[model samples]
Target: MTKTIRTNPLFELYIENNILVINNGEDLKNNGHIKTADIESIEFIRELNFWNKILEVTFGLIVSVKSEYVRIRFKDGFKDLLVTNCDRKKVEYLVYDVNLLILKTQNHHY
Candidate 1:
């Protein structure tokens, strides 16, 4: 059975049969199947805002290619999933782990 891998208040991410599933609030929103053979690379980016090196806060994670554009809520505010005001380390780790799994699955197919 497919199980949820990660979730925030506004989104749920699931991994099943090497495919990534995203749900919004109470329903399925988008789905992407991993084409391990076609994927050239994966990247995870942490978004931050800095001014005069005075304040820096991590907001979101941006994934190359497949997850380039996504919107998610951060705290009580809404922002692009790639540009949020949520916990940075946590989101980064989650995306990294998911990418690893995708790569592992690709390797297994060969």
Candidate 2:
């Protein structure tokens, strides 16, 4: 088992044997064996909210676009595995360590 990349009360994200595992609490919600060839694209988003001329909140999202599902990771502290349609073009606003996701998915190709 690979070291967990992120963990929260609702879900844990990790890469095991080149498979992306999203463990929902004690149950196995979904897992994906990632191949770089299977990834259509990866997108990163950073969100900022302003209040009183100061940035109040920040969040990050990493979206992995595959043919079957769009994997999304929010900032490491949240406990939600957001699942939606596989339309990669429609996802918006979430956060995570983008470089980590890219590295895992890309390096697994070999």
Candidate 3:
């Protein structure tokens, strides 16, 4: 049987021969290399179901003609979204709707 793996874009991984490199929100330019065997676990929470679900639901809330940085606010917190090479309007709409969903879901989840 194959085990399922979870990952997020926030967590970066690179492998070279016997060396394994992992970068987690530090200086991307200064990523230190290490032995591949040294890495036993990698926890990427960026793709957590909460955020993923919000992204899916927020798919049409923006009214901008060009893509712009969107600030999404929720009941518990907020998030800044910026996806490279995407339709600006679509991204804004997604961010806006996702923010609303976050508030709605958090209320129910709690």
Candidate 4:
């Protein structure tokens, strides 16, 4: 049986073992689950301010950020690719996480 779980702005969707986990709370615990097929689509989080810098350094190229199945384009040419399935707050957290990732990568390189 398939059911659609109520999604929230702060939560993220993850699959473990054979069950889908909805992570919203601070503990990173699975609050709920639903069939994978029940998900209509995924909207990725975006870091616009970060991309602005990336754009200036890498001019003439399109930059995108991917989270789960969602892809966010920082350029006008890719705006049409934004996904509507994700809630804004949840996407915001995901974007913040991405920023942290970039920082970690930079630190490691240095």
Model 1 poorest 10 in a row by lDDT: 64-73
- Work out the TM-score per prediction: 0.45, 0.32, 0.26, 0.30
RMSD of 2: 11.6
Q: Tens digits of per-residue lDDT for model 4 on 1-109?
A: 1222224444454444434455544334434654433332234544445766588468955444443234423323221123234555554455454444444544666
List clashing residue pairs in candidate 1.
Answer: none
Error of 2 at 103 (Å): 7.7
The better-scoring model by TM-score among 1 and 2 is 1
Give the candidates in order of TM-score, highest first. Answer: 1, 2, 4, 3
Across 1-110, the per-residue lDDT of candidate 2 in tens digits comes to: 33332344344444455345555443464543443334334443322233412432233334332222234433332233343322223222212333355666667866
lDDT of 3 by residue, 29-71 (tens): 5345654233322221122245445655687432222322334
What C-alpha lDDT do the candidate models reach, one value each? 0.45, 0.38, 0.38, 0.42
- What's the lDDT for residue 66 in model 2? 26
Clashing pairs in 2: 60-94, 60-95, 60-96, 61-94, 61-95, 74-95
Clashes of 3: 4
TM-score of 1: 0.45
Question: What lDDT would candidate 2 get against the real structure?
Answer: 0.38
Better of 2 and 3 by lDDT: 2
What is the C-alpha local distance difference test score of candidate 4? 0.42
Candidate 2 at residue 52, lDDT?
18
